[model samples]
Target chain A: MRVSLSEFRPPREGAAAPALRELRDEELIERVQQGQRRAFDEIVRRYKGRLNNFILRMVHDPLEAEELTQDTLIRVYVHADKYREIARFSTWVFTIATNLVRNRVRQRKRQPTWLSLNPAPEDDEVPLDPPDPRADPSRQVEREELGRLISHATSRIPEKYRVPFLLREVEQLSYEEIQRVTGLKLGTVRSRINRARARFRRHIKPLLRNEALLAELEQIEARLAAEEGSDSDD
Target chain B: MFCRRARSFISLALDGALPADRTITLTRHLEGCARCREYQTDLQLGRRLLATSAPALADGFEWRLQLRLNRTLQEAARAAASAWDAPPAGAGRWLRGAGLAAVGGLALAAAVGLFLLPGEWSVPAPREPGVPGALVERNAPQEPAPASAPQIAIVEAPATVTSTAGDPTRTSVSGQSRTTWFGREGTGRAVDLRLSGAPDPRGLLERQGWSGGSLEDLRSIATLRDQNRRLRDALAQAQREVILLRAQSDTARGGLAADAGGQREAPQTR
Candidate 1:
């Protein structure tokens, strides 16, 4: 028999089903453990995009990222009973995603490549979003180039350092949280992140010293300071 | 703070992980050192760029995931249902599962008995000299056997053979015939099997191997025995069902006949 997503919700709570979208990750997971299928759907909705983006950056292959993201969610669904409230839901989910990506990376290393009939573009060809019509064309171009450079630099970071680096910079996770997620000692997490930032700067060192960009940054800083001063006077 | 240590602290400060005093010192160092100020600005810019660099998610991602989850759930459900419907294993099946280890044990025992102590055992004497491959039982008259028959060298000690209700010919003692291929290494010599007073090794050595019979023969016998028991159970169930169906048919026919008789009498009385 075909199992629908709605099949798992307990009957008595169906009418009184609360707004799962409004609930926190931990609360939703608790509901999921109780077999509330909507809670699981909500969890999937919440993490699928973030997980996919994170995995894509790590693996540099969108198709593999999508597959890994699905696998991660499926793992969460199947092993929902194993989850405890000891850590944030995001940390646990990211840990699962990182492990899946690590395995994929290892397998890729072993086999490496095959003779393709056709030359394919790089796996991580950045899909640039449309530029704002009102924005300056030169500035938009600079932003796009900088974004591409940053993405390339981040991917260039050694996997050990890159993981904690991305967790800190992109996902904005704390060092302690990265430690928990990566199962690394706090010192290791801090050091890796430190090394990753230094490496990232070296990759874009030329851009950091570019006179035009530096001048623009100075202008923006001055503008921000002037706005703060005006606000203080008011 | 040294520039090297300041850079590390600057990275930590950006993440809000460095202590307040260290942050104060790093801020002061950045103010004094142009290189450190540039390093902090570059790091900030990199972090900002990385934040906005998230690639667009593939379309229909969630739809695809829903399909996978449904498939997974269905497979798990099917597995559980089949497990629930499966019949519990019976004694014959259990013996079949352990049939290999038992065969190995028997082979080891037979090898020990044949090589170690040949004189103490009573080797069955060939009573009929004319019969070539004829098997002669101890204390029983020998019957002539075909040349194609298996040759057995059996040493019997007081052993009890349990007879099954269905097949008397396949009793536990029939295990003797299966030992024929053990020693047929070109000399046409038969392997000598020693039977003790122990309870019959149930179908352990009863069946003949097809071609220089391997341990597979024992496993096949066990499997066949299990199939036989299952078939017998099915037959009994079919018989019980047939009886119940026949009784119901007879009752229905009796009611119809009574109704016909009453209608005929009503027409005559009218």
Candidate 2:
């Protein structure tokens, strides 16, 4: 059985029959090339949420994400002839979104008002760990707090690592899909994702210093270890 | 496994990339290691948090997109239609050719008026004093000068440096020299050229095939006249063709209207 990249996505929503939505991405694009507006509408419906979230995480701006998402789709419509079936449609569209966000991020960097809340590593004369969030009585690592921290940390990671990292973890793209979307070597993808994971952990570690989650983590780890031991014994 | 290697494996395991066998070892390793366990927990927690953190798009996203797409497509269609509906190339070319010929004829007329028209040209006497307002009559050929004396042609040139046109003090170089021509504060004198020891003008004009009676010059003028006539004829033909095209266009439009009316009445009768 041949697995396609589209399998990684969730099942389509709405009462639209699987038979109708079942048109292959390449076929839909061909229909669009033949001036079928319905086919292009199907494409926009399918990729809008995924592309928007991917771009949102990359740029950390909602409005820019929406604009870039629309721009990417319009480009697909305008230059539909440029697309080839050599790669999956998801991969090609994600590549376009990545490039658009990359250019926007580069332009933002040139502006003086574009500031990151996180301090740079070079700002430290001596390597001091980030202040523990647990030390403050007012700052509890609640669900919302944790979500905010994760979002902030995700944004704080260098864009190079952040891009591939989001494509892998949040978007749930496979390693190979990430390699295709980012146009990075497989080995580079692995290392950058690993590095991004480490940085993300470091950023949120102080917040996750809660005793309850650690106790839960320990129980889960112990159960997994026992299962592994039983499988080895058998 | 070493803590560092175990951390990497744990990261891959979080992404579901680790092999099953390595997963077991990583589980056992995590069981033994507190630091690696914390690392795995942080990654999982962050991943879970990120899932819920994706921003929801604003309302009416698809509607807005549809609106933009319509406007964009309409613009593209309009541009394409204009390109397709442009006038035919042959008619435009003929029209352009006629306009260029008319411009060329006007330019040729101006050149003839400037260079070949009879003007107040006089040859200065060799002994006349070189003064600003001194006028010399056209030298009579019967009174011949010495062979060694140079023959010079003097033509009057307008002094663009000062007010010469419509000025009451304007000097006419037509054998009438106004002594008070340069009396006004801003009025300036005309320009004069006295080429001494130059070659004879008549001999030079004959050598260059531009003498008054030279056949080559007359033939060139005749050729220009013939070309002007041909261009006028071509212009007339182009105008007639344009009128014909307009008439054909109007006839086609009328036929279209009649056909449309017939179709409308047929549908009503049915």
Candidate 3:
């Protein structure tokens, strides 16, 4: 039953067979559950990128996010039999990732350690990885500053708001899905996402003061108002 | 007062959760009110700015994660072997043979392998000259392998009528599908399911989280919650009924006492 990757072609529209990478998460996972080691590898290949980005945003530390993402996938492998048909595989994975993030955050707060045992003092804070040198230097600086401000604003937001906000905005999960992920009421999730977005706006607005942004806002406001008037009339 | 509360509703409005009337009111309010409009702009700016700055995974992210997972799994295997090799001083549980464990694991793996065998997905190929493409069950489809042909491993798994990639609703070309196929003349060949990269939506879902519990555990918790709610509701109704009956009994007792007093007064008068 262990088909060679050479023979592992699924039915696709144009190709003679679908590539291994084209397999759905559920399909890969199903095969994994059925003792296909390569299937699990496929899953790792698919989710690692998305999971890394999500964890990085939440933890704000690159190393920790990688560790947490790895741990999450490991859990998926060991507990493949625990997933049910009722929820999406992605939801389950995200939930695991989020819970791990929460624990890491809680642990960090409990024992505040800014520094770890390292031979060199200079290794205390790892800087952001280098930017593309060929790109304009000034633009890179501005983008970096903006990126840092975004990260800072996100970190400053309360967890109650931040969790739903990140899941909705970054992960692109629906409000109902956010409720499932966080075990929060629908209303509460919406409210928190709203507050988180608003707070983010407050933090970053000063950095991005442009007349063009204001002009766009005005246009959106007008369009919404016209639609609102029609809806109210009805 | 409307300004503060409307701000929260504005988020809902933006998300298209607000009702028609509320949407109209909020929009009209935005048109008249500059402060509220400013609040709306902030919301938009927040969303627009964040959307512009999505995160990218660090370089070598996948390679490192894979390396870590391999190391962890190897370590786990080592730990298991070590535990089996040396049990605690008093515990007799370690007496179980590692060979038996190995057999069990292999057997489980083989069963899983058998379940995934591509032969199970084969639609019955007609070997006879006049076999119709109509909905007729090829009850017995398995054929004895000739010396030259590769052994086609038939999956005894339930007949899953998987269709071609173009149409999901259409059943597999096994004509009338059967859970079990019998040995019949001429209907020996089958084209099994060609499961490519498409997701099997019918695939069972199982997830375990940091809570150290399965989705089943969460489902059971939800079921227990429903039962608790029903019991609480029943208790509340019973309590209400008890109060109503007690009041009625008290009223009857009062009437009886009044009647007794009237009779005593009549006797005194006599």
Candidate 4:
């Protein structure tokens, strides 16, 4: 079966690698301000997937994520003069993205009910089938259950907690950077992450016990690791 | 430090967010306490699961972003170029200079025309003395001059008398004409003596009794003629001054035009 880009890359191996990559975001932004088209291209290449995924999770629509990503980059170009070194460039960029997402959500709320006939693609539908009993069904079942549980739990999270949770857990932003991006206090960010953790645990604990789900998760992990190996080789 | 405050630190410790020394202490404490230890494991597991479960974005997202940046840069460049190419301040200055020169030229022409022309002077051509005899015969009879022989027979004597009747007193006083010949010596001066026609000189003097009346009339007429002559001379002088002023005005205008032409041509020459 053909794998999607989402399934290709493994989780980041070490914390230090992302930290080093993040140090370049500011340099790229400076170059963009100086009219370096290639620097802007590099920035898009670096953050497009991550920003798209973040927006996709928030909006839950691929087309909307694509459009919002474009809008985010355009906004960065228009407002590049306003970028300051006091905050990390990634935090500033994400702040713009989050604001756009919030506005899109609000606009969607104000639109008439008839116009909203097309719903977002159902993320809850599991792609993998139930494992055979003859096979290592227990682990396969566990991974599938865990995937469904995670999707449901994250989908249910309110925007306020979901945004902080995504930034902290998925984007892996520092607390101070999250505060800058979300315009929330450090205390509030910490509490929201704690609450998101509690909610995530409540949803995932039952699914974590499935033997088949665990096996499927291990298989997914191995595939992800192999993809990462290939990417590093490239 | 306080009873309830330790819970906040416990929460922080679960997130691996406490200070280094505090983290060590918190971890040691958590190892002994099952509840805190469970909380830490739950938090770590939640973080890991959330990280893995979130979807990754589509590929080649950066390329689209770069395209957008390029388009924006182009738009900005176009705007800058247009702003730079707009008409400049020098054009306005040149227009103002041209307008001022035009107004000044018109004002100078009008001033010369309105204030500089001679007043009440009419020009007449010179006439020959012989034309008077022809003119007199066409209009009326001519009076004959006195002759030394006194033997010329004049058949137009009646016509002369009839014509002189229009000046009846002069015709009636032909006997006394020789006495006034000395008084008509000065240019533009006239003397009148009617001694023969008057019946009584004392009665004539009594009838016009104002003292020095004749002398005053002659003096007043001479003064008026002199004033008129002075006025004519002054008017002619003023007209000449006006002509000179007009010439100067024209010359100045030519100079201004030449200067402006030079300025215009300087750039071409360069």
Worst 10 residues of 1 chain B by lDDT: B180-189
Ranking by TM-score: 1, 3, 2, 4
TM-score of 4: 0.48
Off by over 4 Å in 2: A1-18, A23-27, A111-147, A206-234, B19-28, B77-270
lDDT of 2 by residue, B72-118 (tens): 54455344334322323474445434332432233233333334333
User: Model 3, A1-234: lDDT tens per residue?
Assistant: 222223322222122224556787787778766766666767776687678767877899877888898899988976887887578788889999999999999999999687766675244333333454544655445445555677888888888788898888777788888889899999889889888877777777775577765564455456546755864464
Per-residue lDDT over B1-270 for candidate 4, one digit per residue giving the tens place of the 0 to 100 score: 332244456656655688888766665665667765565665666665655554544444443444444445445434433332222336323422332243234344333333433231111222233553211121113435544322111111001111222321121124422101100011000111111221222333244442321222223334334433443343344334434444654676676567557777999989
TM-score for each predicted model, relative to the true structure: 0.54, 0.51, 0.52, 0.48
Model 3 chain A weakest 10-residue run by lDDT: A8-17
Q: Which stretches of candidate 1 lie over 4 Å from their true place?
A: A1-18, A114-148, A207-234, B77-270
lDDT per prediction? 0.60, 0.58, 0.57, 0.53
DockQ-best of 1 and 4: 1
Q: In model 1, what are the clashing residue pairs, if there are any?
A: B174-B206, B175-B205, B175-B206
lDDT of 4 by residue, A68-171 (tens): 98899778766666798888888998899999999999998998645557876355421333333433555445544554567677777888888988887777
What's candidate 3's DockQ score?
0.14
Q: Regarding TM-score, does 2 or 4 come out ahead?
A: 2
Global Cα lDDT for candidate 3: 0.57
How do the candidates rank by lDDT, highest first?
1, 2, 3, 4
TM-score value, chain A, candidate 3: 0.70
Report the lDDT tens digits of candidate 1 across residue range B1-270. Answer: 789999989888887778988888888898899988888888988765565555656555665666576666555544433432232456323322233233223333433444544653223333353555443223322333423312222322221112223321121224323222211111111222322222222233343322111123324334444444443454344334434433553564455457557866997899
